[model samples]
Target chain A: MIKQFPIQQFLDENGKILNKDIRSQITTELVKNFYQHCVRIRTFDRKAISLQRQGRIGTYAPFEGQEAAQVGSALALQQDDWLFPTYRDHGAAMTFGHSLRNILLFWNGRNEGCIPPEGKKIFPPAIPIATQIPHAAGAAYAEKRKGTKNAAIVYFGDGATSEGDFHEGINFASVMKAPVVLFNQNNGYAISVPINKQMSSQTIAQKALAYDIPGVRIDGNDIFVVYFETLKALERARQGQGPTLIEAVTWRYGAHTTADDPSKYRDQTESQQRRHTMDPLLRIEHFMKNEGMYDEHWINEIEEAAQAEIDLAVQEMEEFPVANPADIFDHVFAEPTWGIQKQKEEYLRLLEVNP
Target chain B: MMNTVIQTKTLTLVQAINEAMDTMLKENEQVILLGEDIGKNGGVFRATDGLQEKYGEDRVLDTPLSEAGFVGAAIGMAVNGFRPVVEIQFLGFIYPAYEQIMTHASRLRMRTMGYYTVPMVIRAPYGAGVRAPEIHCDSTEAIFTHMPGIKVVCPSNPYDAKGLLIAAIEDPDPVLFLEPMRSYRSVRDEVPDGKYIVEIGKGNRLIEGEDVTLISWGAMVPVALKAAEQMKVRGIHCDVLDLRTLYPLDHELIAESVQKTGRTVIVHEAHATGGVGNDIVSIINDTSFLFQKAPVERVTGFDTPVPYFGFEDHYLPTPKRVVHAIEKVMKY
Candidate 1:
């Protein structure tokens, strides 16, 4: 049983090549671009966490240790393909061309953060787990119906697999041959609920078997495997072969969210230990060095570029205008209903009187 | 001299919904339908019959059992410049997608400073009259009404259903269109063949009377109409106001009706406590309390979980209950 489900990996934690058949696919250009995006998103994630700590932004869900899962998968997508992301997948969103300032504004409790850049097929981060799955299927189905080659990819966590929406999305995509990729980051916990307590299945990939969809497990820490496999899955989707479930076994180096305390449930030391052995960025560095392609000048340039970009986004986000309280009621419907109008008036009146 | 004649055809509430979706799908390439068994099965009640066949599978999509997933996805599609008409199998099953509707679909536009609009409609068969399973027959308009984002629409007849549904699909914001399952195939009227849209947030006057005003929606609208007919024979003429849209209520119409009759009786199929009836009662009290000839009376379903199929008719508000309340208001 274990033989059939052996984890597919292109690179190992020791910076050694594990799968020679796909080694040639890792061109120097591909490695550099992958490294740049992964590093850029990691910097963005750190800045977001700091902003939350300073109370500059509202509560944020950090995706630190899962950078390879986000960066690799996002890098594989064409600009026209659709992306359905979760609250914690902003790292992926940013890599896929979402605005950093708007993302910051979103965490600052500003509604503007939910807006995607012009013409980008990126959805606002869904807070409800597994809800985006069916939406992805529907969109992919729509694309297939329109005779478009574009496919859709949705990101969810380990905990989301238990949701009825997950099963529904995969089943529909499978039967309808919708062009979609069901990407799951097995981060081991949903808030404080461990994977063991959440479900009886050995892995999230196995759940795809029930839907008769192809499932693959991969070393999420290996960026090379992640990028190549995601490309293949997306290609299969565009070919009208239906959906694929790719379980990127990964971990969350930080708390589930800024408001959460992971120390309450698990050992911080264990997380620290994993950081030393399986850090995605370090693993890539090790691979590049072993391949004699590592350059200190290039790495320094990438860091400086990422930091500058993040700094500029922070300035833009900070310079944005203050949010109007009445905005809360304005967009509920295209035309605010009479009830909403009445409520908005009452709220404004209350604000005036109080002021 | 020339003679002109008008032609008409009768259709059920569900038939009106089907016609509305059919018309919209035909006219707009952006408008699409997605829900469990809504395609080949034409919905559990067949409200979406012939849609998939006519529009092809692209416009009318049969989604999986993931209410949250499909509903959320529809929001995504809507934001990405498509008008998605999604169906939640039943009212009670909508809870799983509540967060998405309230958080993302409802707030996306405002959050983005109007950069994005969720032009999506979530259609579900609601209210407790057909007495399905425990979760199958809940009336959850109040829960949605309390949410800041999203428009809640509940139509009472074939005419209103066809028009309101078109309006919902065309609206720029997310809408929750609640269909009364009990009246799906029970009510009928002639629906226009061409494109038409009912203005959301408006009410329609079903009857004009002087003694009292009865305000209701969905299944209770028919009940209120029946009660008004009975009250007329008893020398108590009652005005009936059908609240086509529950969220953005036609308060002007409601207030005007209450002032004219000087007495108000609110009727609904939802449970009494905190239902849409309560909201109407409060509105009347706030705006036209002085016009009241008597305290506003509410005739609503008991504050209990909608009972089993065997006892559903008893639990739901009936024409007799509305008439009783109207008589009491008149006597008072």
Candidate 2:
């Protein structure tokens, strides 16, 4: 049966709740928090792009259009759960307690960017596509073995579905009943290749069926759907049911990274139209206004706070010590191999000669 | 009677591996064994036999045939505080998991700047001469030796296998533990019981001589020894060093041996082009240049894919080849 996975939603684009059951759970404070986080990460993402263009940082992967999927799913994880993010998922990482300074430093090409805060089981953003899928599964299996209540969530893109790791991770996790959630953002393109050109499979969620697990399709632009669905999936994991694959149908409104232009492959006007109709931030704003929870003064305060926070993080990142070339050799092993030591010395000699 | 008490036990290479894993599982709660058919099937070669029953399914996992998944998963488990020993069934089959091993597992420590260190072991049965067919007999330990973070290890005998596997598990870095499939059943030696470690970067000198140095590892070790024995009969005393760990290299041991002998012959079953032999030759050229009485010679397989069964004998390095290499080196 090739029945379509109905695109599940909890709020319309205009901000009215489509589900009555969630109305009680939705509070003004929760709405305010969601708006603030969305704005905060959006601010971080835009500032990062500007930094890249100004040569302040390395190439940046922006998530301006995928904030709800990042923030909502991150908000669903428990304090002790594991989060495995990709190069494009730092918005999710920040929402999950990752340091803004460290995230900035990561884009600056420092190894210090990979370190997670104490007690936060956040893996470094995997640059290799789909590699973190199995890692998240494995981490979840460790928690299950320890008989802990912890779970894991792995974030990937639409293109990652075509990777061998996606199947391997999902299949293994399914067979082992690992306590993990496979969260996929269907952002439509991998660098330049569209999803249709990449894989024949119509939906990322449908691939989960092959592994015999629950597959969900949600409006990633709608915060409530993303948050509630991820929580439901995670609850299944902690109860030993197994992993759930969530296909967050979303879009990226900018270039894949600061180095490329989106207009080369797709029409700019189409993107602008999509942004007006499907932007996650605008969708939330619509909902806040509909619920009469939207306060202009409070909203102004949030934008200002986000700007100040991002500015401080930029300062902190810039003030960090310059990356020592020796740390690269030193940390290659727990103890440097003799070969590494010799290479380090040779490098130093070469530098001295050049200088 | 007390003086006559038997302590050392003779076991095969596979038996030594099983016992070492059993000991680790018993001693440390974090040690886990995972691979295809390792659980109910006790592994394709029975190296992990009865471990699933003894340690339970939680510790001994029977993974699917996906190498990338399980290997990457093992890296994660290691990062999350579990010491996972993963098996790739065959060394040839490990290619599918190479990205996980090379890009992620090897770089985790360096990329995280030591905030995260991967403490894991990837066990693969390598080398040829057992006639196991194509895609099953790869002796490419040199590939891993080229990597910076991973410790490349190969044990030629039961004693070394057990000790090296323990050391590999205890090591804070990722280790590529290559087992000699040819010696798995053929080579039996007296192995000590309980926990022991053969340090990852030290070379073992099997025999000492003043004439020439014979360096080898894995299945080539016995061939080197036999050649040395033959040289001894011809009154050409030779020193032999088994390079247990190839990457960090026992450069000191290799240098000392080459210095004393003033000549050297490196033997291996892998193709000659970019093998570990070249690295050793360069080191000898650098350190023992003044001590050399003859040019270095290498007895290695041809620079080609390992041929199928009938031509396999000609494809692998032989004691004859090693002896020939020694003769050629001495003549130089």
Candidate 3:
């Protein structure tokens, strides 16, 4: 018989702890780190939206209300574990050591932006919905066969679960016992189609039941729950216990992208209400106040520091040399095919003749 | 190493593929096999038979029936520095994994601007003529050739299959190696033992003539050669060029053959409309059109889905059709 899976939360919307056992786990240093990273990413998200508005960057997808879900799960990863992110998961990528400058360049349509820094197993943002699901499964399986304890974590939205790749990835990982965490952020909209219209299922977490793996539903606005639960799922993977599906129940306050307008489909009043009631950063600030650790001086310092870091990355991305047009022809293959060679030569000849 | 003598062995096309995988797996620890029924069952076509028993389960994985999942995972493994060779049971079944192959695996190098290279090989039994039921007999490789940043290759015999599969796995790019269903056992030859590299993006000029250049790959190579043999009886000599790699087509070879012959007749099993033959004709027209003696003709399948066995032979490009096209081009 199918049963209801309750959403788990350590901190409620009013900065109250529903789980008493988590009280001792909340350290001053931990909360401070969460607050700082949260502010940093939020600032970056806002700046990206502004850049797109000014034509400084191409279309941008903002993660304004999904900071905790990104930061917490990313923080839970070991250095060697792989991370597969989607177009909207750059906040998670940045937290996991992707360069801010590269992130900016990616929005500007440069290929350099797609690359992760050396030794970081972060994948390029999968533009196709749920395509990374199987890729993450395969990479994690590779680690298992090599006798390594390394695992992988992949991120997608509620909309991606509808794609065939979602079920395929889940089924394979379940059967092979691959070490992977399928992190799903139920953001309620897939380019204006709400979750209610997309699927008849009550929850994305329930889809994991058909595959027979652990499915978890959590309050993504509560960083403590997101962090601890992801850590547990990853541990199960490292222990060879197989994969886990985490459905992070969250919301998106901004439009899907700079090119979209949310006002057409949904009411702005509800979003304004959620900002005060369920904002992840505000929840943490409230917790710090209750614990007597809230400081205006520290908050201002983090704010100024986040602004400075974003400013430097913006400058670096803009100042980088323009990509060569010939680069488009090269690297199609390790050795360019004769056809590619001919096309490249023909293209250049046309330019020369015209000039 | 270059001075060392190469040993040769006689085997079927499928056997040659197994041998190539065996040698590669034994040679490199990083190489692994993943596919449905690929482990204990050896593969649906037996192309990867016995590799699992020899290499063990860790290296030779029998994956669940999820083409998109497994193929995408192979790409993931590729980016993480593992050389994964994936086997899709049938070419028609590749629709499920097309998103992975086209959107991600093919574009990974170009999108990342060379920071990431997917060093993997995807092998599938493609083409028709063995009377396979449905979906399994699509010879339409144009779907893959149409995409850039991916090397599309089809080996016509045991020797080239072995060498090309090896080269595909080792190369720092994703390669689609199509093993025609008809050639599994029907086509056999003296395949060399030990390692050999049949360079990708090059055409093999199987036979030489001056009347017309007959161009094809995969299953149709046999048809082209047969037609060439028949044409020779009428003193209509023709040059037969096997395009081993379709995407990075050996235009140089096509150009030279077309220039000398001053005529061309392209044959393939796919529909004539969007077939890679059309691409070849376009390339020849662009490069060797001025030297052309007659309009290029194409002996290709009808612009329709591969029909049932009732009309299969009629649908396929027969040697008679190739001869007709050759005769028509020559008379012009």
Candidate 4:
């Protein structure tokens, strides 16, 4: 049953374009867009991990090896579409026009980090697994009812499939014909619990059969495949044909989060070997070289520009306004209830007396 | 009631809720009704009776029996410019969606720093009486009250039901609207027609007196009122307070009433352990402790799960128990 959804790929391990049909469709501008975003997000992820190590930011979730999956799916979204990302999907959010400073602020343990830029339809990173699935469905349903072409894309890990909300959200979307794409990035493990330990199902894509939605599996390391498949899914959603489940099988070369230790559960050597054979960035660079579009200085300029932008974001994040303790009581509701007001007043009085 | 000639109708608590939802649905195009059996079936309690037919399937949705799914989806709809009112068949059945409520719906506003507000309501018929089976009559509003972001509103009568439901639907945050199952059709009041808000976070003093302060809400409000009537006959005037909103309990009313009486008896059907009544005691201690002439007494259900209907009467707080607590506080 799992073999029914064989891993689809446009670029193989050697960066050869296997799909001749999409050859002409892949323009120089399109490949460059993918390449730039992948590099930019990868730079952001690595800098974030380093910040965490330096105690400049709190624990960070890195998408080092999964850059292609995040960049591809995020680039496929329209400007008006909604994006529901998990805590690890900040890379995707950054790719979708979320502010890099705010993303860094979030890692720095500031509430202001949660706020998306003005008019951006990106939701705060959902910390809980699978809970955002139904939220995305509901958002898509709302857009569908309003007679808009806008759709929603929700990203989750492979372990999220075992949750009841995942099934419920997909079932509801299927029944309602909601314009949503359940983007599953199967990164092999949920912390230390590998995919097989979490579910008996061989493939996350196969779970779509239960909800009666079209499910496809793709090589997540291949940026071309991830981009086109997500675009196809989004197009289907916009056409009112209902949701499609796309499983981008990928790997994370780092710990689940800064607090986790991947070395304790999985072989570190395997992750090191995957970098050479199936790195998302290496695959893209391989394709660029094979297409004779790999300019060494141009690529160096992209890397340098990405680093400079990330450094500025880090500085801005550090210089962000100091958090006011009163804000804890203020945002609990639109207007503070009496109890909250009284508590805040008493605390403020205490602060004044003590200070 | 509005001063202008707004029509009034005698309605049961359930009917008042139906009217409230009807009014909101009619007035606001963004008001959406979704829950299991809510559309054609009009809800298990018929609180949403005839709404689907009047509105369309899109407006009044009959959702799958996934509490977490629908509630979470409602939160999404709420953030996306829709005011969703979700009905959980019973309060006990809401545990499946408790994570969504606690982690998402309640915290979304604070988590997003006010960029998004979940203006949604979760209406669950709670409390024991009328012989509901296990887990069907749980009155566990305390679990929600402990959380800060969500407002917990419970109305004891039809008038407050309609007004508070309207207020909750209009409020710019998530509200857990608890409707006592026992009071659903057992009591009737002249519910004012048209739109009105009873005001969240305010307590209503039903029967004012100079004696003991009787604090209660939801199904227990009737029990407290009955006990107050008995005390009145015994030459002890009582102050009966219905705390419409549990999260932000009416501090001023409670302080004023407790200060005047110098004695208090908090009544509720939920378990005595960690119940809202304990919060009332804390409020009295905080604001009116110097005025207190006696230790506060609490009349509540035993710290046990609500029993089956056959044994439910013994498990619920009664007027007799409340009277005993009142007498104990008075004597103390």
lDDT of 3 by residue, B231-312 (tens): 8999989899999999778989999999999999999999989889889988998999799999999999999999886678
- lDDT per residue as tens, model 1, A198-275: 998777788777888889998888888888889999999999899999999999999999999999999889899999
lDDT of 3 by residue, A1-355 (tens): 1248788899988778888987888889999988899999999999999999899999999989999999999999999999999999999999999999999999999988988898898889989899999889888987887789999999999999999899888888888899999999998899899998999988888887898898999989899999999999999999998999999999999999998999999998989999999999999999889989899999999999999999999999999998776888886877777768778999888888994
lDDT of 4: 0.92
> Which order, best to worst by DockQ?
2, 4, 3, 1
Q: Model 3 chain B — which ten-residue stretch has the worst lDDT?
A: B131-140
In CAPRI terms, where does candidate 3 land?
medium
TM-score pick, better of 1 and 4? 4
How big is the positional error of residue A62 in model 3, measured in Å on the Cα after superposition? 0.8
C-alpha lDDT (0 to 100) for residue A90 of candidate 1: 92
- Report per-candidate DockQ: 0.55, 0.87, 0.77, 0.81
Pick by DockQ: 2 or 3, better one? 2
Identify the superior model by lDDT, candidate 1 or candidate 3: 3
Candidate 2, residues B210-236, lDDT tens digits: the string is 899999999899999999999999999
**lDDT values of the candidates?**
0.86, 0.91, 0.91, 0.92
TM-score of chain A of each: 0.96, 0.97, 0.97, 0.99
Instruction: Count backbone clashes in candidate 4.
Output: 1
- Model 4, B1-332: lDDT tens digits are 55768779999999999999999999999999989999899999999899999999999999988999999888888888899999999999999898899999999889888998899999999988877777899989999999879999999999999999999999999999999989999899998998998999998999989999999999988899999999999999999999999988889999999999999998888999999989988988889889999999988889988888888889888999999989898888
True interface contacts reproduced by each model, as a fraction? 0.65, 0.83, 0.80, 0.70
User: Which consecutive 10 residues in model 2 chain A have the weakest lDDT in total?
Assistant: A1-10
Q: Evaluate model 3: give its TM-score.
A: 0.97
* Residue-by-residue lDDT tens digits, candidate 2, A1-355: 1367888889988887898999999988887788789999999999999999899999999988999999999999999999999999999999999999999999999889989888888999999999999999999999998999899999999999889999999988999999999999998999899988988877778887788899999999999999999999999999999999999999998999998998899887977998889988898888878777778998899999999999999999999999777887899998888888999999989989995
